[model samples]
Target: MFKKAFFAGIPVAILCLGLLTGSCQSTGTNKRDKEGFTAIFDGKTLQGWEGDPTYWRVEEGALVGEITPTTLLKTNSFIIWKGGTPADFEFKGSFRITTDGNTGINYRSEQLTDIPFALKGYQADIDGKIRYTGQNYEERGRTTLAYRGEKVTVNTQQNAADPESFRANVKNNAWQARQVTGSLGSSDSLQTFIKSNDWNDFHLIIKGNRLLHYVNGKLMSDVTDNDTVNRKMQGLLGVQVHVGPPMKVQYRNLRIKQL
Candidate 1:
């Protein structure tokens, strides 16, 4: 299932810590207001990461992901934040989505083969506008574990009904929280909040055998890493440009930690 090779996945998951939206967030275990941590992005330019900044851009002070109507941006570049790879890495941060549609971030991935998940690993569940806030569902693969309220049904095809009812719960055009974490090939896990045209904070934790998804600073989804997820491929991360609704989503304060 070998297809293409992404850029040389970078190492040193840099830390972009500071006051976001004037909340004075001391991210990182040491705290952003503390010491011994390094800054990954300066919030001015894309210096360390290398790739087609076509779909991704620096707007105002956030990493805005734009998809021009008819055009979509998909890259084959390994854009590293600091440089190098981390054996036990944990990526955490928040994104402010402006549009209310489908979009996502891909990580621990490699080349896309004919069968899909070629070098594919795990995808944090960001679909289903009908679910509650900050839910992590597996896409394109088997789900180790998940939760669906009795009122909600997860069909055999994994489809849901009354999605509009669920969509109504969204805060609309605001900042939410999201997170995804996992090791490259041999481990994977992801998490995200329900769809909202707003900003959300996320923290994804991934180790050798465990993957956790946290939304809105709450541990919403959690599961153990499996052999099915730990296959081949070690590619860089990518933000999605969905195919409907002429939508727009912005991701900012993206930071990853190496364990």
Candidate 2:
């Protein structure tokens, strides 16, 4: 009878161990399994965002934007997120662009009725040609605040005081040439990190006046905006469908963490 009891207990213990293993593996499909980030895309519908139906849709578990020759845009367009305007946050998503397409992730932006579904503010530049991926650009504002592989501090006051002197000081320095400083690796190195025409991860971390952009885990640009008069503190978020040659761009696995 004792031997029989021991064998019965062995089976119960095995079942308990299997149940524990199954529980440990059921963490959902969200990327990174990050502890605090919230998913913004439901992967099935455009429930929380707004954009021109002509250019945006949900396809194959991704948010897709396509523009054909007949659907050419008169001006740039965006799919604005209706979620609360984030002041400080970390945003991440996977993106892919066709050879002729260009897109950007716009944040801290405002919608303008002048151009329907248009957004104006900071943009994380993305292009199929890999020319501007992972850079900081301001839509309809102070464009190209920081380029790939740059660490910049924008001080409009100093730049305005002595334009010629400032230009000369940072002449050979790519970062300072933009009236900003440099950090991380060189632009050439950044280009190597970007995978053109393929799915790649883009990330943005924004806290107050400081912003950081990354591509595929490589630091692309960092900026500290000192232009208090023009720098935006917070606003809407959107993705762009640049007005140019016909093409397509797809985005997936979007998540954000408010800081």
Evaluate candidate 2 by giving its C-alpha RMSD to the native, one decimal: 15.3
lDDT of 1 by residue, 1-259 (tens): 2234322222223332222122233444324422322344546666555433545567776766555665443332223333433334566666655444455555555434343222233444443252333333333333322332111112222121235432332233211111223221111222333335666777767665455666676565554433332222233454554445544566677665554
Candidate 2's C-alpha runs over 4 A off are 1-33, 158-178
Candidate 1: give its CA RMSD in angstroms. Answer: 12.5
> Model 1 residue 138 lDDT?
35
lDDT of 2: 0.77
lDDT of 1 at 39: 45
Best of the candidates, TM-score:
2
Estimate the Cα RMSD of every predicted model relative to the unseen true structure: 12.5, 15.3
The lDDT leader among the candidates is: 2
